[model samples]
Target: MSEVKEMAAKQERQALTGNEAMALAMRQIEPDVVAAYPITPQTEIVQIFSTYVADGLVNTEYVPVESEHSAMSAVVGSAAAGARSMTATSANGLALMWEILYIASGTRLPIVMPVVNRALSGPINIHCDHSDTMGARDSGWIQIFSENAQEAYDNMFQAIRIAEHPDVLLPAMVTTDGFIISHGMEIVNTLDDKTIKDFLGTYKIPRNLLDVDNPITVGPLALQDFYFETKVAQADAMMKAKPVILEIAEEYEKLSGRKYSFFEEYRLDDADVAIVVLGSTAGTAKVVVDNLRKEGIKAGLLKLRVFRPFPYEELKEALKHVDVIGVLDRSDSFASLGGPVFSELRAAMYDMETRPLVTNYVYGLGGRDIDLHMIEQAYRELLEIKETGKVDQYVNYLGVRE
Candidate 1:
């Protein structure tokens, strides 16, 4: 951001719920098309944006679909036709779009969806949890998790650039916790419409369906031979997304003065025990770490921002110095071992010459509350692991009554 714009942005910070902040960001960016289906916490976003269209605030087509499945389909169709497109949805809504999610990324569409993280259900819930997004980790989309409303707002612009980057034309989802970030209000420093417009520049696709002079097919069925190659190509693009994500983050930081990375490190230098987490719970964990430090305990936190295109190598180097690390997951993978994050981190650290002793802490599934006490217990376990040089159990559930 320019110095004057930055100062104005700081002064004009608005108190908004995550949904309102995201909708406002969408308005600022003003993509060509927005096709969405509302569910619980995510409903407010499109509801707010729909009013923008009605009031002539943004020149964008707003499609209110019957279901999340149709919502994703609408964006995919619009994006393939070379329009900048977006959507928003919550847990069950996200699940409904499962099939189309893969097709969106597989066909290399730079669609952006803001997902409000909620527990995926058989018991049926409408509250905060990571199960919804965690279940779609391998669906060929870039997954960026937000800690609060501010990140949710900022990430929308960054996600647009990242998804539309020349080398990384993949669908992306920026997620915030349901009820936690989505319904709660916080002050967000927002860029002006002109700044976001300049940041996004223009939306272009090399071979869009609408280009009749240079017609090309999209989403054709591929059998065993070519399909394997397509998968490999998509994987290559996903790996390429890491650098693109970071580069865009640096540019965004210069613009907004809010730095972001694959993960955030909090006082890791001299700490012996640390906690690794994702989403809003990281905020709670930070408080626990702060209190632990005041008592002379060497504790720290690493809050992960990007889950898909997992930063395996960078993460290993970051945590190798710590003695014991507690990797917390808000979703249960239920493989009889632990959650998705624990398995990935353990594997990532496997080859580190001086790796930290890591244990899994599965907490806050189905929107169960994880208070400061739960985070403190996680740190306590880490301290014990550091002191004894032993991990009694690799997988442990937190704040749950057996």
Candidate 2:
């Protein structure tokens, strides 16, 4: 038949929004279970995947729940039952699942959730911000930030492999900026279904609650007598995930012809002034760095991908030579001092032999525009710090009306 072709074909390049790309990856993954509730910004992902389920494109049991809490609970039950499970959410949806988030991780279920980063509500905004995931950063899940649609697509395959790895049996949340990357269309090169399937191999629940022959408890009461040890074990697994993530990324690179590391260092080695950021903002920062370099400003940028394990050591080594640094945040920490990213970054470099003057620029809350001009201003401030050897303002709100 001329209809069917060989599976070894080159990757297919298609224009896809981040939500569609993530849904496409899930269709290719064909996980055993996907229990989710619709939420702004993230609803499209599961909605598209539901179409796959309807069209018989995938064999996944799609469960549509009423609330994010129920959505997460259903997946936790599915994951504990030894099913490859996944879910997607945004903003308040993630906040609603706060209780179950810990349960999913505490039980060591390798559930993969695609969190569309959105600002948490009091004012009820349905836009991009890192506050949702940053709020759950300490919940024992690996946090991966995507710069664009392609990373969102590629990270899905890697997230499943990383989460299910025996040495690191933990959940992972691959995140994308709400409307910025989630709804923005871009050309993405996607692997064929067979390629991704082969890459994922097969998943067998090592501690299967469904396995009657080798029955084991999923989650039981842990007081101070064993709560500390249980936490230590989970912490150890999280630490082991660092190497597993890199290893899985390496394999995915060979299959996809795209390389990845914990974070991307864009012209940072010889930099005198550096900017460190996460999510879609990094894309804007890279452009600013290129223009600054053309003007002979030794400017550089580092875009962090993995945020949970923190990559403290690698970050320390990478920024050791830079003269001054700036960290831009899309979400305010509201702690009065600085945002979560800037705070963690300062702590990471605290023990350096000669730490650079660091500045925190909190911007883009509630999906506010963070354009090239704003990013250029951040770099200029870092240059000032480099020149004067002092930071006039340690923390700032970049585009606020004051």
Give lDDT tens digits, candidate 2, residues 173-203: 9999999999999999889898899999877
Model 1: CA > 4 A from native: 1-11
Residue range 1-402, candidate 1, lDDT tens digits? 777575656645899999999999999989899998879989999999999999999999988889999999999999999999999988999999999999999999999999999998879888888999999999999999999999999899999999999999999999999999999999888877887899998999778999989988898889986999999999999999999999999998877888999999998878899989999999988899999999999999999999989999889888888999998999987865678888999888888788789899999888899999989988988888888999999889898887
- Please state the error at residue 10 of candidate 2 in Å: 0.4
Clash counts for all predictions: 1, 0
lDDT over C-alpha atoms for residue 122 of model 1: 77
RMSD of each: 1.7, 3.2
Residue 4 lDDT, candidate 2, scale 0-100 = 18
Q: Which ten residues in a row have the lowest lDDT in candidate 1?
A: 3-12
